[model samples]
Target: MNIKIYQRGGFKDNHDVLINATEYFCKMLMSTRMCNTLNIRLEMRSTKLGKNGLGSCYTDALGSKKNKDFIVIVKRDAPITDQLKTLAHECVHIHQKATNLLQYRLWKSDGKFHARWNGEELGVYDAIPYQDRPWEIEAYFLEDIMHKAYFFNNKNRPDLEEKIINGFNNALNYLESERSNNYRNIVSRQSNSLEMAI
Candidate 1:
């Protein structure tokens, strides 16, 4: 798979170290057709988005089949595993956009029309129920599998299978942690209510 990475905004301070890592993850995550035909670019920036989130893929402006180029933006300073995971997630979105699986649900507010995907409103960054979003769910489901595959294919150790399994387990643990964080507020509220009742 042919993957291009562009680093900006102090991203080179790390001594241009992550190019190979990003290239490896992109090749492992993206499909063979996409890797071979389209020129995929990953843009990395070192900036804090303040809870808005980690990474994103933009494919809305271009024509569907003709413009096969897709962009994935990620925080340059994020942990390597997180960077990989985020890339994998955005890769799924790219596929969805490429294959016409990304359909918008239009909603009118204040006489203005807006688009959304799987009930998550687009253009606006208001908090949405993330775990319930179908696209996010699919991405979450695929990220770990992709990670495992990457490890399996890249590793040449005698315990290659073990390393692959460990990769899967590590990603699953990360997903569980995300799920816990997502619902922690609700759990805390319920606990407080129960304590009050007592």
Candidate 2:
């Protein structure tokens, strides 16, 4: 149930960055009510990432009974703040999978089977519209929230002052949107129940 951090592509020179990020992320997750005594392995790696990819999170298998190991890979040379944001983003994916809100399945392709999210075989990573992907939208919307809280609480990183402000604003907006969505769901459910009773 330990979080293991690894470095590569010269990130070893800034080993402290990886350690600090892992500690902060782990602490935040531990504090959450949903995460009661984390028993899953979280592997955070700082290494060369795909072009245009700041970070990414994926598991060997996606399900409650299968492997719960989460592999979070980030750019080795990114700024500490940016790296923290990536960690937050990836951690959201881990949380989603752990909660069963996000699930995957294997699909046949060219005589081979490939894994995909929510059973959408054709919806490849980049092929899926950014906003249409609920998982990405949730992760992207919440990453800034987590980063802002961490940076504000730390308060020693003046270099990230601007980012902190931006994150704060983004978090507020996301919270509002989430509230609205929740209200809508409740109302729709109530209406359906009433109609069924009638």
Candidate 3:
């Protein structure tokens, strides 16, 4: 597993700065995810795949018969929230590809861009599992949870808890709208699935 993050020196506004900081934290937190799930530290590596203003991801499918582990790349200067969302989205892709390519779903396909997934849309996470649109909903939720976690973990934040709560509420609004009825269904199914397996 590989997760790399870089900062671009040119940030013109406060929002831009926040976005940059968010990207850095989000990338680091992704390593924690990889560690918990794959039981290894995700390596950080610089890639020549795409320019900072654009986006990118690459993989070799290491350590298993299928797409078990792989390399990923992204430009250093993308928006933090959007980029974090994309990162979570791409991780979902890796999960999908590993699950016998059954989970990979890119709706309204664009050109070959790994991190710039789904489409040029607001909610990219919900664009997975093609036939089952609920995956994107969960992806968006995961991104928010991670974002709030990052914000709360940030020592520099003056009002960290408030910011996290507000961000979560905002995310909930969007997810509630996007997932509609399937939100409860998905959560219920997930709970039951875990219960039976455990």
Candidate 4:
């Protein structure tokens, strides 16, 4: 996909790492053809998202068939691992929207959001609890798989581990060279380093 990243507040100093991670997440979640046709915007926000809200995905169109553009917002203050997981979760939503597996509509009469899964309307969005939503259930299930595949299982992508290690080291080196206390703190919190696991 044509991926654009915008960072605000705490994430402004780590643009390169976010870009690399976004591209990696998109590639992992989307097919090559789908990637070529879609445009994605990932916005990193340092603003509070309330308790348990890590990220969200928004589409250009209500119907999945017309939704080719997506905007994803992620909480930047979270740890790197949590940020990546949230990205993966939002990426799953993008895939869901792009493939017409999930769709949403806003009713002007009731002024409420409605959702559909494979052509079945599921009532108002707010009526269902967040965790009980089918799309969320699917995204949550896939996010763990994506995270594990990226960090642990890479038989299908033998070069992935090495690439991640190199990228992680390069990020650390950049942070050290810049000598930015903010960047150092960011890296320190990401103690769940790829190098440590790999």
Model 2 C-alpha lDDT versus the unseen true structure: 0.60
- Compared with the true structure, what per-residue lDDT tens digits does model 1 show for residues 1-198? 446788766646533334454455455444566556655677886654456577887654432233366777887788776777777678777766555445433335543333344323454323445554545765766676765555555565537756665665575566446553543544565568779999
Provide the RMSD of all predictions against the true structure, rounded to 1 decimal: 7.6, 10.3, 12.2, 13.3
- Cα lDDT of candidate 3 equals 0.45
Per-residue lDDT over 1-198 for candidate 3, one digit per residue giving the tens place of the 0 to 100 score: 333334345442444443444344434333445433431122222345444422333454232234444444433445656555555554544443443332232445562222222222224433345434454445545555655555565656648756665665576466546554557765666668779999
In order of appearance, the predictions have TM-scores of: 0.58, 0.61, 0.36, 0.71
Stretches of model 1 off by over 4 angstroms after superposition? 9-31, 61-67, 104-128, 157-198
Q: In model 2, what lDDT does residue 51 have? A: 67
Q: What are the lDDT figures for the candidates, one per model?
A: 0.59, 0.60, 0.45, 0.70
- By lDDT, the best candidate is 4
TM-score (C-alpha, index-matched) for candidate 1: 0.58
Winner by TM-score: 4
Order by lDDT, highest first: 4, 2, 1, 3
Error of 2 at 141 (Å): 0.7
What are the clash counts of all predictions, listed in order?
0, 0, 2, 0
